[model samples]
Target: MKQKKKMTSTGFLLLITIVLFFVMYAAGMVIFADKGFAKPQMFLNLFVSNAGLLVIACGLTIVMITGGIDISVGSVTALVCMVMADLMENKGASAYVAVLAALGIGLLFGIVQGYLVTYMGIQPFIVTLAGMFFGRGLTAIISTDMIAIKNKLFLKWANYRFYMPFGSTNKKGKFIPAYIPPTVVIALIVVLLCAILLKYRKFGRKLYAIGGNKQSALMMGLDVKKTMFKAYVLNGFLAGLGGFLFCLNSCAGFVEQAKGLEMDAISSAVIGGTLLSGGVGTPIGTMFGVLIKGTISSLITAQGSLSSWWVRIVLSALLCFFIVIQSVLASAKKKK
Candidate 1:
């Protein structure tokens, strides 16, 4: 009975998110038709542009599912980007080596943050907040100036595009094939794997269990601390890879990189039907949430008159809307 209730709630939230995305996209298509918003390439750009955020947001989803939050993801991304940039541009390191460094940086943060939160029983917010400051500070220590990655291999990966068969035509009636980069492929794979893990894996069940009720989970013989520790570790690794992907897009790194990204990830997860209090969320829903955000940006850019800050205003409004819905549902459930 409990499982059924959970499924019903999840499905309801997912349906709302999916429908909202399509509605927003459709409206954009209608309003911005002259700007080619209806084009396949335009749709694909959403995925291409936000591939890194998608991955990072997925990691946030995992942590949120366990009723824990990590506010340091954005800083971690900055740190990773700075480290990679320094290694490749200044140290004459190969892209392969930089990749290793990215993973290692992420793992190191994860281990420390996870240990603090789990073993030492520190509040996740406090631990990750310190991490956030440390990461940004360390990034500045590496270099105050920006580092543009000129590594041939890294640029090759960045510039490479996979063209789709169907696309729009130019004024001369020539077909223009839509293309996507490798980052989109990687991001989508992460989403799929996360979805599968949450829906089918034992670890996923444990996450939901602990988030739903830590006491009940402990009574049921679940190791709440260990599971949460693993979640942070995994989130750290994803944040690292996400930073790499974000770096791929920018191909440059500085102290100010990826500022406010933690909020974006958190909002994306919440808008996608993940409860802030925890125990309920899905990667598929989060994917649509990301699309909705991308659509908002594309719409604003196409309008050309609106300030970019409007995107935040609109997103905050949507975030508030969803939180209200979640609270309403929670109240109803309690009453039942």
Candidate 2:
């Protein structure tokens, strides 16, 4: 008789997160009933508000699965937004051109960091740290001030919304429609593509092999350097995409844009079931992780009396708890 394999730690963590989200959401609805946290719009708003973070978290999940990290993604996102804003607002460039330029910069930045990490034998942390500083410095050099985006095409896209079939009535006796932003749609597409790439592609398989054990992957004749390098490139591209979505949400850019956003992405990825030790994760799980953060923030907002910093405090605590769980899981795997 064939025995069924035990559920993996990643699977277990993902299940926990899924349950946690529903539990937290239910708790919020019970506590903030008067504030209408139970509305469908409130739920839809989670995706609409966190579309950018979704993309960023997906990118971070990919890199983490390859047993590497990119602390510079948030800075890269800021740089992308700043560059796009400057090009459109100051240089009189077309929105299309500005967006392409931002994507190109992100790709270039990723390639350089990847090259240093994979070819030059530099540590991922040190290289990404340098990349982070460089990105932030370039952003400031462009302009320390916030630059509002006034491009007609960009504005049109930002304002475009797709309303859901169902809606809720506000306390004012008016029908409030639920809709998702174009950015949310874009983020969803990216997530789907990433999910496919990671689950069904040869490159994705190699990444898992490498992350599971570099020596074994090398023995199996995988192109470790090339795969790792391409992983960073993909991460960079996604970061750029995330920056564009974030700009759509904010309609402005500044040097401080997306500050500490890397932490958010990382924490989200971790919470989503991506192991820091690598070789275990899913994009779908990361999406849920992003939603969890959005839900927390929404709950805090509904409370009204809570400090905004409460979100950060709660997130940090959750991050710590997840990391501890990962550590325990790793230890168990080693023992087995």
Candidate 3:
């Protein structure tokens, strides 16, 4: 019962934040949107357009909750994206083959990082930081140019949209499309898997225990090294998945893709009330948190006037604000 209440409180906090984001977004639209601040499509774009980031952020959330961080994800994702595109276009691999290749690449990278963190006793931060550099350097070596995916299967998947006709169309001549985006589907799958693992599975409970107190968990006979390794391995794998979805969405991959994504992922997890101090969080919360971050960028982009840099600046401020709130809240909880 006590745990349930805590979950409720955390959920309420998340809800309040979502409301606040909407308020800020509405204000921005009113002042900035030239067409009187009313557009239905704007709302749709929030979840659909930035869906790839949403997926990646969700994956990053899992690693953060384990009392660890992964900085290499952004660059690794870029590499996966490039690999997928290159394989499909130049190597004439089918979309399915390219996907397997991308995921396999992600798995391989995850294994390397996991081995370092768990076996070598390297700090997750340092290990992943090295990973970040290595991945980015490889991406640089691969090419700085944006490569597009012209594969027919890939193109159809990207453009596939579901439409629900509501009075023909809206003010922008856009239909009320509820079409599924591959990125959104992938994000949902991640969310569902995380939910099941964290809530209903023994491994998930073990994860929580490990994060709560690594020494205690080890003394309790939990396989600390294996769990930690899996955390990082999974993190790397998800980064790769995020990369594939990202490239699919943009139809290309560049060395600079998903830059600063680690920060964004960390921010999303923290904002969702996942403790940086370790232990306690839900993928559902993380999903909402990513949506909030994505929404901010979408609002800014919709205006088409504000510099894209504002997206980073605005998110940074919000990230700090949420971190402060979390610190205060955690301290108060401890005092109680």
Candidate 4:
């Protein structure tokens, strides 16, 4: 009965998020029809622009589902970008080598932070806060200035686009093919893999159990600590991959790159219906959250007069709203 209730609540939250996204997007299409908000390319641009955030949000969802938070992901992304930029631009490293280095850096942080949180029993926020500082400090140490990536391979990856069979026509009546970069493909794959892991894998079940109640999970003979450690490690890896994708989009790196991005990831997961208290989230829902974010940004840009900061403002409002909803549902469950 409890399981059914959990499933029902999860579905309810996800449905709300999906409906909200469509409603907001429809409004944009109607209000900005002259501005091409209805264009297919405009819709595709959301994914193209936010692929990195999508991947990072998936990682955040995983950690949050385990009742943990990592505020260091934004710092990690900055560090990864700076390191990759320094490697390929200055040290003459191949893009492939730089990519491997990014993954290694992420793994190193994951191992260290995960060990601290799981084995040492340190609070996750404290440990990741220190991590956040360390990562940003290390990024500045690499170079405070922006390093633009001029590597051929890296540029090739950034420039490459896959065109769709269908698209909108231009003023000249020429069909402009809608396209996406490899980053979108990677983000979508991450979402699919994470959804599968949480839904079908034993490890995922253990995570859910631990998040629901640590003592109960222990009673069930689940390796709670190890599972949490693995969760952080996986999150770190995704942070690295997401940072790389972000770099592909920008083709540059600086100390301030991806600043405050951690909040964006957290908000995306939350707005997607991932409970801050843990044990409830879906990657598919998170994807829609990201799309919602993208839609808001696009809408603001289309409006032309509104400041971009409105995106943050609206997201903050939405975040608070969902958190309240989650609390209410949780309270009602307790009463039942």
Candidate 5:
């Protein structure tokens, strides 16, 4: 009974977020009926639009659960995109080479940051802040101007769509097909893999133990340093993957690409019930968090009257609300 109660409490915020999404979606259905917000395509659009964000948020969730954070993810993602763009567009590199280079850069960034944080005893925020500057600086050095990706292979992949069996019909009786983007499919696969890593792996259990209490974890013979280091490295790889997905969506890259994207990832993770204090989170919840943000943006777009900034405002409010709830839950757990 105690274990069950603990699990329920841990998941409280996730449940609240799920409820909030449904309520908002139901409201959108009523308010934007004519705009087809009620259509199935709108529902799938959430995944298609925020697929990259979903992957990043899942990465962030892993870090947060281990009592670490990476503020440089946005910059790193932009750098990855810029590197891939520079390689393929300017240097005539093959698509395979560009993709591999982007992933390698991401992994390298993670390894360095992880080393500093785990071995050198640097604060995560300070280390990641430096990382942010380095990544953004490198991106600018590569090219300040936007580079449109004209790589035939990349274009083919980006344009490819997997049509859903069901779709809505327009007033002209033409079938408006619903489709999932490759990026969205990639995000889903990442989420599933993360779910398995967190739930069933030995490293995952150690991560939670360390987050719960570092001293206790050490006392129990856990290799706290190595586990935490590995966590950040994994985060970097996922951030790189997310950058690739973002590039797919845009089919272009620039120094400014994904500016402030780290915040979005962090917000999604928090809203998904990943505790800032660490030791708890789920990738599935993070996916819903991304979906919620996408839904808000969709609702705003469907209305066609509100400024895009409203999405930020609403998300900020939601983020704050979830944070407060987390604080209260943490306090209660302590009292217990």
Candidate 6:
């Protein structure tokens, strides 16, 4: 056999990073430079603002890589947080215990969806679309209002910030200034682990293979169903994890949290060059994609000149454009 072509991933990642950096840089200059973005807490908001998006995008990337989509992830996230709040308040469960229970619920959904798609020969789109509805309704059943989390452990974790020693000088010739949150640290760790898995592991490789061509992968004896099943489970788990973090950050949970977030995750994946039809993508690209999308919102919000809804308009156009480009590229590669 010809030496298996190892996917050269960094080029795509670098491109996304460069594009995202410029977007952020431009936004910062236009919106934040007046005070050098020098608000005491503004620096820290950079990480906090995009933390949940990063986590959501990371999970979504894995599912996409397997040629499957988890449109329900956003809803699952909302439901997971609802579970946490209900368990803590109604059942008097500890926050830690509630979190695990939430994760379990996510895993349960994963199993159901995975089974339907893999064993029943159901289409991913159909299975996950139904899952999306199920998760949404479940979230509504739990609560339609914002459920405030007052658990002691949850509050303590939410309030903690991991600060770096550095800053601006004060008028008195003393230093004044910044901090980072534990959320950023947690987000980074999750992103890093995902990158490593997507880039290095055997399962990761198998994910690409199954996504690239299910028939060919099966001919080579790869357990296609099993792989996709694992990917979905992981996606659900991450959704749950992300939901928990989002709750920790916002200190509340509601049915509508992360609304339309599946699109956000998919858009990030595509911009980062993860093929829509499947088989190619990276966590790094998804990360940059999240940053870029986040920057757009920041740009619009900071200007105070337009409704943030414009962000969606731009994202929709970009998504269409990228999908077309991807289709053309996949065809060309096939002919070659």
Alpha-carbon RMSD, each predicted model: 2.2, 2.4, 3.2, 2.1, 2.0, 3.8
The residue-by-residue lDDT of candidate 1 on 1-336, one tens digit each, is: 233454676678878899999999999999999999999999999999999999999999999999899999999999999999999989998999999999898888888999999899999999999999999999999999999999999999999999999999988999999999999999999999999999999999999999999999999999999999999999999999999999999999899999988988888999999998999998988998888899998999999999998988898899999999888878777777
- Give candidate 3's error at residue 11 in angstroms: 4.6
Off by over 4 Å in 4: 1-7
Q: 173-260, model 5: which lDDT tens digit per residue?
A: 9998899989989999999999999999999899898888889999999999999999999999988999899889888889888888
Per-residue alpha-carbon lDDT of candidate 4 for residues 23-122, written as tens digits (9 for 90 to 100): 9999999999999989898899999999999999999899999999999999999999999999999999999999999989888888899999999999
Candidate 5 accuracy as TM-score: 0.96
Model 5, C-alpha of 301: deviation from truth (Å): 2.0
Best by TM-score: 4
Deviation in Å, model 2, residue 170 alpha carbon = 3.2
Q: lDDT of candidate 6?
A: 0.78
Single out the weakest 10-residue window by summed lDDT for candidate 4. 1-10
For model 2, how many clashes?
0
Candidate 6 clashes between residue pairs 3 or more apart in a chain or in different chains: none
TM-score of 1: 0.96
Identify the runs in model 3 with alpha carbons over 4 angstroms from their true place: 1-13, 25-40, 164-168, 171-176
* Candidate 5 segments exceeding 4 Å error: 1-7
Q: What value does the lDDT take at residue 172 in candidate 1?
A: 100
Question: Considering summed lDDT, which 10 consecutive residues are worst modelled in model 1?
Answer: 1-10
CA error at residue 116 for candidate 6, angstroms:
1.1
TM-score of each: 0.96, 0.96, 0.89, 0.97, 0.96, 0.89
lDDT of 6 by residue, 82-191 (tens): 88888887789998898798779778888888888888889888888898888889989988887888899888988887766776665698776566667778888999
| CA lDDT, candidate 1, residue 309 | 89
For candidate 2, the 10 contiguous residues with the lowest summed lDDT are: 1-10
Q: Show pairs that collide, candidate 3.
A: 162-179
